[model samples]
Target: MPRFHLVSDPDDPVVAPFRAIKERDLVGREGLFIAEGETVLRAFTRDAPQRVVSLLIDPKRREKLADVFAGLPEFTPIYLAEQGVLDAIAGFHLHRGILAVGRKPPAVAARDLLASLPARAMVLVLCGIANHDNMGGIYRNAAAFGADAIVLDADCCDPLYRKAIRVSVGAVLSVPTARLSRDESIADLLDATGFEGLALSPSADEILATLKPAARTAVLLGTEGPGLSPDVMARARRIGIPMANSFDSLNVATTSGIVLHHLRFLGG
Candidate 1:
């Protein structure tokens, strides 16, 4: 079991990283990230325990969380605080009373991630996806439907952002994710790997369900309002979901689930 430490003061030097976490997360935390709530904590500890740096929790729940502590590395610090002290440290009311500091793993090349996939693979390529909630939701879809990996352009939001990780229910922790460098074309690498790009667009001539699934496929999605730019869509074939009442678009995350579901069980 990891040793537990007592911390009554919010300004304690050891707790500095947890102070004003919201602001630090937005500005970037030097490769570290904050994970909140019980479910998110469980996912991190179970899937990526090596990434954990430390944890801060309310004392009242220690008994219930004994197993979680037991699973951590021997040197990992577990800090205890009363609920009020926890609130003061977080600079806001923290009802869940469970938080962890985790380190982001080093960047992996996009080609490296794609090359590791199985022969028949399905992946999601995200372009200009700046919303954390949507980023999280899409990851959840990717995990649920067995997407082999996720690739993003430089314009996408960080999937490790606290809210995005929480909203994804830790799917981001499980999925193999990588982002394209500024000059890299998402299409070139995908084509080189023999993966067909299926860009999601409302103006496309082909409806989504009508097409045959490719042996290796990448479903490309973009931001809500503007959708995919022609250049970014590149040489990919465009596909669209037919909606009732002439709705031209659906939320990107929702569209991912629909598209992935069809591709997964039906062949894509």
Candidate 2:
């Protein structure tokens, strides 16, 4: 069992990283991100244990999380506090009584991540996806469908945001991710990486169900309101999900789930 340090005072510097969690969530300190709830923490423990820096728990829930604590590194500090103290420190009522701080690994180049994939691979490419919730949901879907990796353009929101990590149930930790350079175009990168780019758009020449999957496929998705940019759509083979009664669109996350699920079982 890791040693539990009692943190009674909300102002304790040891727990400062967690102070005003909601307000400072987007501001990661020294590449560290906050992981909330037991489910996300468990995923982190199983998938990225080395990234865990420390943990904070309500004293009443300590015994309940013994297995979790036992899995951490010996040097990891586990801070215990009463519920009220914990709530005060976080600036909200943390019903789960569990929170962890984790570090992000060094950024991997998009080309390098793509180059490392096997011949048979499915990749999800996001362009201008600014909503963190949608980003997290897409990552969860990618993991579920066994996507090789996710490549995000510079415009996408940070997947490491606390709510996104919580919403994804920690899929962000498990799936390999890379960001595109400012000068890179999503279509050109896919082409150079030897992937057949399929851009999902409402107006497209081909229906998604009609196209055969390639040995290496990269599905391109865009922001909710604008969809893919004109340049991006022009560069790739445009495909659309068929809807009845002229219903043209779905949420970007939901569309990704449906498209990824279809591609997962597509025999090359």
- What lDDT score belongs to each candidate, Candidate 1 first? 0.89, 0.88
Q: Residue 23 in candidate 2 has what lDDT?
A: 83
Please give the clash total of every predicted structure, in order.
0, 0
TM-score of each: 0.96, 0.95
Query: What digit string (tens of lDDT, one per residue) describes model 1 on residues 49-146?
Result: 88999999999879988888888999899999999999999989999999999999888888989888999999999999999999999999998998
lDDT of 2: 0.88
Off by over 4 Å in 1: none
TM-score of 2: 0.95
Clashing residue pairs for model 1: none
Question: For candidate 2, lDDT tens digit of each residue in 199-242?
Answer: 88767778877678788899998887787788888888778787
Candidate 2, residue 218: how far the Cα is off, in Å: 0.9
